[model samples]
Target: MNNFYKNYSGIILLLGGIILGSIAGLVFGKDVVALKPIGDIFLNLLFTAVIPLVFFSVASAIAGISKTNKLSRMMGIMVIVFLATVLISAFLTIMAVRLFPIHEQLQALKITEKIEDKPLADQLTQLFTTDEFYQLLSRRSMLAMIIFSVLIGFATLRAREKASGFVRFLNEGNEVFKHVFILIMKLGPIGLGAYFAYQVGVFGPQLFGAYAKSLGLYYGFGIFYFFALFSVYAFVAGGIRGFKRYWANNIIPSATAIGTCSSIANIPANLNAAKKIGVPDYITNVTIPLGATLHKDGSSISSIVKMAVVFALFGRDFNSADAILLALGMTVLVSIVEGGIPNGGYVGELLFISAYGFPPEALPPAMIIGTLVDPLATLLNSTGDTVAAMLVARFSEGKNWMDVKEAA
Candidate 1:
């Protein structure tokens, strides 16, 4: 029963939200716009907690690492896997979008533009200059935050005794922030309902149908993309049997993520899944929590694919240089920097458009599109977490689980 609840809670919430949203739209209709501020308040509450939560959690995790070499190896493997997963997911999504082609003949939606324009040269300069560069690297901007967190974690280790007190404080702070995050998550369904209603009320449900086929295609591709990448990683690290066991245990986390469309909210379920899969507490404590914030396979895929679609929408043929730059830029910004925050991907997409000097009017439509797609992406992201945790556990145990299974 406990396992069933975990596995199905997300589906229940998602279905509930949709039902409620549709009812709200039918009744209140245009008046649903009034709910915008309430939804915004919830989003603000979630966002307000992100920066501190990230800093403390990362710092404490780093401080807890007892051996520099072990930490380095773990981090090396984590980064490589993260990037590779993201790139593969992105490549597949791009292909799906091209082949399936959502809204091929539909006119672009006109909405209030939130993007800021700059000359192409200026945009390039912004991407490279020291101040802007640091923003991306440090993740003070969405793209820089992950880089900054990793650096701070490593630096805390170097600080050793000098930073011990600070590290302890960070740990304490992480606990407090976690409590706050929980409080916000409890209100998520309501927030989602309100936001969805407001969106439908303002734009009308017809808008979704305008690209309904595309949206459906996106979701379908996202599901396949997740399983394909995770299957390979699981087989490589955990063997087929271990992989099967891992998935069996992780159903709840995957369901919860799909329902809530928030990876952070799925942390408890993920940790529980990790424990059930026989991962060490230290590994689960460190990786699951960190993964909630930094590992965003689903969001990375969506961001990259969306960017490609956006370019195609504008009838701009992407040259090799353009595609490479955009992919690298997105890999840094979407996958790493904005990995953990609630609605982080939506904000990152806006920044991507702004930084690229795309028309500001594109933002509102992008937001609308991204919001609709986020839940599906979040599900994929959570599934990736399970796959990653299993792999990490296999590697850390210093046994070739995959080979053992093969021999069996």
Candidate 2:
């Protein structure tokens, strides 16, 4: 009972809050909006930590990589695999959007237009911030911060001894914030509950009705892609019997991912699943960790879907050849910085705004769809990590990967 509560308390609280909040909404109508402040406070608390959390997490992730030659080869192969999968995933997403286009029903709802147009050169320059401190203070450019953190991490790797102290400090800083972040996550029940209550209370069922097609399409496509692509990869690597064995071993990581909705949080489970599936310790240790931070096939797919939907709603020509190509490339590039994205795909929404110039008004429904399907995305992400590790092991170490597999 204790363990069950421990595991499910957040879901329980969220459901309770929503139920009660909805009742209040129905009974009291707009008066129920008084509860909005509770959710706002919680969101503010989480947002407070976003900048530092992203900065330290990215920096520490890079700094943790050792300056070893073999590991370098492993990282290179891992990246190649990661990009290969991302490119394929992105293309699939674009194609899916083009095929099952969302209808023009949402055109009735007027959306806010709050985008600032800039010259191509100026837009390009904005990606890299000029003043680090100013950027940090303003919280304006997450890409710039991510870029800087990665550089610092690489520098520490190259100047091992000279920068050892600084690296240690960064590691310590990350740990401290990580603990704080965990504590903040403990407030999920109250935060998400209040937020959902306010949302459902105000918008009613029509809110969900608005995004039904987009959500349905994303989830449906995600499942198909995961099974289809993962099955193919497993079959290629280990044949029929091996494919069955691989999926059998990967059940735990897949479940952990859906439960936690976080790839980074599923590291231990992924590592365990990797071991069960016979990924070497060396490969799992480096590749799984890095993959969690970098690989975001699930997020990429959802982002593309959201972008396509938003573009269509705003009367943009999303199906044009140039638009499709830009969307594909942007998915890959935005995915690289996905680590900095806040939960519920908020940062991803910003990426759409910046990359494709989608209107800010269209963000709410897109976010709603992203939040609804996050579990599916995380499931793909977590399971994909383990699969990627297997691929990395097979590619880096040759086809004898499963020879070391323990017999069933």
Candidate 3:
């Protein structure tokens, strides 16, 4: 019972809050719009705090990596595998949204108009870098800030002992912001509750149907990815034997991912499973730990789905080739900086809205979908790391990695 409560408490509170807010809307009708300020206050707090939160967390996540680990063959292969799987998962989700149509098809949003006036090359340049550093300090240029943070991390890596104190500062800052985020989330039950009340009041209940439909698509595809996609990854790593070995040892890790809803939490299980599946310790140690934060097929899917839902809600054309490509790339980045902390998906959602120039109202629904889809998403996310370890081992240790382990 204690474990159950500990694992499920957040979902319960969030759901309870939404339920209460929805009730208030049904009962109070348009008068519930009075609660809009309360919701705004919550959004304001999140937006204000998230800028530093992202900078510090992302910088530190990168800074903590050992320089030796940064230059290895294992790192390169792991990165390729991560990107490949993320692209596959993201494209899958995009296709699913098209075939099923989770929300009512609507016209493109105003942002699409802006996209037409700007040249593609110029827009790409601006997305990656800012004209000035001060611009990165704002959420409007999140991609720039992330790029800068990554550079800082790499720079710190190069500085070695000379930058020890600064490295400590980055790590400490990451911890501080994590706690700060926790404090902010204490208001979630109330804040999100009020926001939902405002949503139901102002937007009508039709949006709820969209939420239900999207959530269903996410869960359905998540399960398929877990069972089918993972099998294929394992098969690539070790052929028929590797496929059998993967299923033999992966159940506990998969279970932990679902139960905890955290990739970080599933690390030990992944490590143990990888060892059993004969991944070299060198490969297991790096991929599982890095994959906890960096490699996330599940979050990739979630990000694509979140982007589509936001587009649909705003009457935007999600099917545009440019939008699809941008969404695919953003999924990879979102998977990179998505902290392994509680409510971390909030940062990713914030990045989505800001990157696309969506108004603040789009945030709540994305966040709610994240909450609803988290369990299965984490399952795909955490287990994929172990599978990635298999791929890395296959590359690093040769095609007969499993046989080599037995022979050794």
Candidate topping TM-score: 3
Flag regions of model 2 displaced more than 4 Å.
Answer: 1-5, 11-48, 108-113, 117-122, 129-133, 179-205, 240-242, 259-265, 308-367, 400-408
Better of 2 and 3 by TM-score: 3
Candidate 3 — which residues are off by over 4 angstroms? 69-71, 105-119
lDDT of 2 at 91: 90
Q: What does candidate 3's lDDT look like per residue over 350-378, in tens digits?
A: 88788777778888889899888888878
- Candidate 1 worst ten-residue window by lDDT: 137-146
Answer with 1 or 2, whichever has the higher TM-score: 2
User: What is the C-alpha lDDT profile of model 1 across 172-263, one tens digit per residue?
Assistant: 98789867766775665676667767766765665455446556777787777666767777777667766687778867887788666678
Per-candidate TM-score against the hidden true structure: 0.66, 0.79, 0.95
User: For residues 1-408, could you state the per-residue lDDT of candidate 2 as single tens digits?
Assistant: 685566446446555655665566666665656777776676566556656766776787777777778687888888888898888888988778768775344453344455554554565566555565666533446556667878878878778888888888888987787667667756655665565556566656544444778888888999998899988877766677558867998888887776666778889988988887787889999888788868888988987887766775566666666667667766765566555222535555555554454443454455456666777888887788888888888888778777865542
> What C-alpha lDDT do the candidate models reach, one value each?
0.64, 0.70, 0.84
- Provide C-alpha RMSD values for all models, in order: 6.0, 4.3, 2.4
- What is the lDDT for 172 in model 1? 95
